[model samples]
Target: ASNAYGNSVGRLVRLAVIILFIYAGLLGLTGLGFKIVPGGFLPTQDRGYAIVFAQLPDASSLDRTQAVVDKISKIAHETPGILNTVEFAGFNLFGG
Candidate 1:
């Protein structure tokens, strides 16, 4: 087995030009892959969580905002297939 392995290594050494070409081709394919594939750590998916945003007219009172949030939370809790509701009154996520 050792003798056969030595002969194979000798043959490959003699084919250095072919080996270099194959290596270059593989590297080209890798660069092409980077261009073809989408770049993201994780693919976008529906994780079953939903965000509800509520907006009121300008100059609305904090109490009014809380009331609207509480009403939305209550309705969400009473609805079927909704596991839970989180209320964030007077907070505008997109406004920041």
Candidate 2:
């Protein structure tokens, strides 16, 4: 078995060509599989909460930010299918 394997490896040109063809075929099949599959890798799931970020200019005052946040919260509460909303002014979850 070792001798046969060695002989096959000795044919570097043929082995390289065969390997390249196999790799290309596998890649083509992967592309085809993606085209045939629907809805992508992860299906959308509804988690019960949503976050709204109201961003103002860099030099904007806290009062301005608070007013914007309040308006957004009010609008969200008026919209259907939204249970509740929580607002934070002069604070960032990602930044902090």
By TM-score, how accurate is candidate 1?
Answer: 0.51
Q: How accurate is candidate 1 locally (lDDT)?
A: 0.88
For 1-96, candidate 1 gives per-residue lDDT tens digits of: 999999999898879978899999999999999998877655566466879988899989999999999999999899898998778988989875
lDDT of 2 by residue, 1-96 (tens): 999888888898788999999999999999998888775555556476787787788989999999999999999999998998888999977894
lDDT of 2: 0.87
Candidate 1, pairs of clashing residues: none
Q: Give Cα distance to truth, residue 90, candidate 2, Å.
A: 0.5
Error of 2 at 12 (Å): 45
Best by lDDT: 1
